[model samples]
Target: MDLELFLQQLANAISLGSLYALLAIGYTMVYGILRLINFAHGDIFMFGTYMAFYMMTSFLLPWGAAFFIAIILTIAFGVLVEKAAYKPLRNSPRMSIMISAIGASFLIENLAIVVFGGRPKSLPVPDLFNRIIHIGNVSVVSITFITPIITMVALAVLMFIVNKTKTGMAMRAVSKDYEAARLMGIDVNFIITFTFAIGSALAAIGGIMWGLKYPSLLPLMGVMPGLKCFIAAVIGGIGDIRGAVIGGFILGLIEIMLIAVFPELTGYRDAFAFVLLIVILLVKPTGIMGKNIAEKV
Candidate 1:
């Protein structure tokens, strides 16, 4: 209602949107290549968070080093999951692959519960990241303000890697037609593995940032962001990189605005997305930027 409140809400939306965008990129990239929804992605995100926790607490590593290590381990976990679970069923019925993904998700979540315990842990935050910067009517912490910029830069780098490099070409080819790509002498397995690696790495960045922003670390923390990011990918037209970013921002704005206007609906935040999802599916199942893909049956 007031300018100050509006500005604060806007800041919150942008910060929240950045995290969504990072998470959505991974979803969109994997979906683009494999045409499979990795249900375990959320758990992979949780893995990243735990990796960060171990690096910081056990290894006594600096934040930057811990973050990098988390990325590496999380990426490895994702690749291993693919090799063990999804890859075996790559040639099987689509439903089989989907089920494998679901199984993997369950395995990771249960394992996390066993390892991290049922109790929630608070993420260790450095003092530097705790400072708030007040500019004009908008009051956002330095970490909050800077996070979106970092996320956007990361997205830009990802776009360059996916669109401008040789590997990028191979990825595009696989996404377009895997069999055709293989026939063209493209290393299908390598490209698929690379895709998973990058996707998982990006998810790690998001997980770390999410932990930094919210300061809560748990096995289930990824569930909400993972689900929300999936919605973002769908809204932006699944498989489209730019679409995912746009969708993330839009979804973030909607959620923040709804919560700001009607605090009571805070309980309905998840419901809000499904409602919007259903409406979008009814109106444009292909999403805002999704193309009508016709397959020769």
Candidate 2:
């Protein structure tokens, strides 16, 4: 490929990777704290985008206000899901919690279809996102640049919260042993709910970005992206934040480059993630940054 084309593809890859990383971080954070996969997370993503869409179209709010409100609502929804679906099953077997998560996912998707209607709706793109930028022979949307910067800033803030604060210490302790942390005076339930709130916020931001990039919305839109981000989390080492970012970038690059190099394989783009997942699981089931842990008896 020519240099310009390659650069264009690279920009697309980075943008897509940023979205994946944002979503994957949510997955990693929840798993890190609760040892539970929030399968409903992608639906939360869909909910956020729909909320923003309605805020803009139905409520006639500006993009900034719409996005802010949508994120807040999404966070609340996520916490509710935690309390209603996962919290009660926490002391139960892991399998039971997993099933609950799946059921929650289905419930949200069906509800979305009923509420948002099954028809695909177009997101009204803001001028800022739609504006085109030129660099030599390559041109790309402004969102391409904005996405990575947003991802980096969000990651930095999250790292600070996770590494440099008392809350972080409590979170780490809880992750190590919930009962032990509770014994040590940490509010374990609060920590889990806080983690969900953060995860939901990220999902909301990612969903907004996804809508700007793709513009078309469907009830099932989050399904593929959600699964792909989950794979990204697993590939990066599910509980490690840095690993999730690395895995997301790697997945994005491979998918974009594969399609660019061989246009015929465009149809198989989704398959690439699954193939990578299988390879990672076989080669390093614990993931690149994941340390093997003894199963709790």
Q: What C-alpha lDDT do the candidate models reach, one value each? A: 0.88, 0.95
lDDT of 2 at 122: 86
lDDT of 2 by residue, 17-55 (tens): 999999999999999998888899999999999999999
**What lDDT does candidate 2 reach at residue 268?**
93
Clashes of each: 0, 0
lDDT of 1 by residue, 1-297 (tens): 788998898889998888898888899999999998888888898899889988999999998898899999999999999999988898888889998988888888888889899887877987667787888866788778877997889889999998899999999999999889999999999999999999899889889888888887888888878888999999999999888888888898999999999998999888887788888899988788899876533
After superposing candidate 1 on the true structure, give the runs of residues whose Cα lies further than 4 Å from its correct spot: none
TM-score of each: 0.97, 0.99
How big is the positional error of residue 270 in model 1, measured in Å on the Cα after superposition? 1.6
Q: Which residue pairs overlap in candidate 2's backbone?
A: none
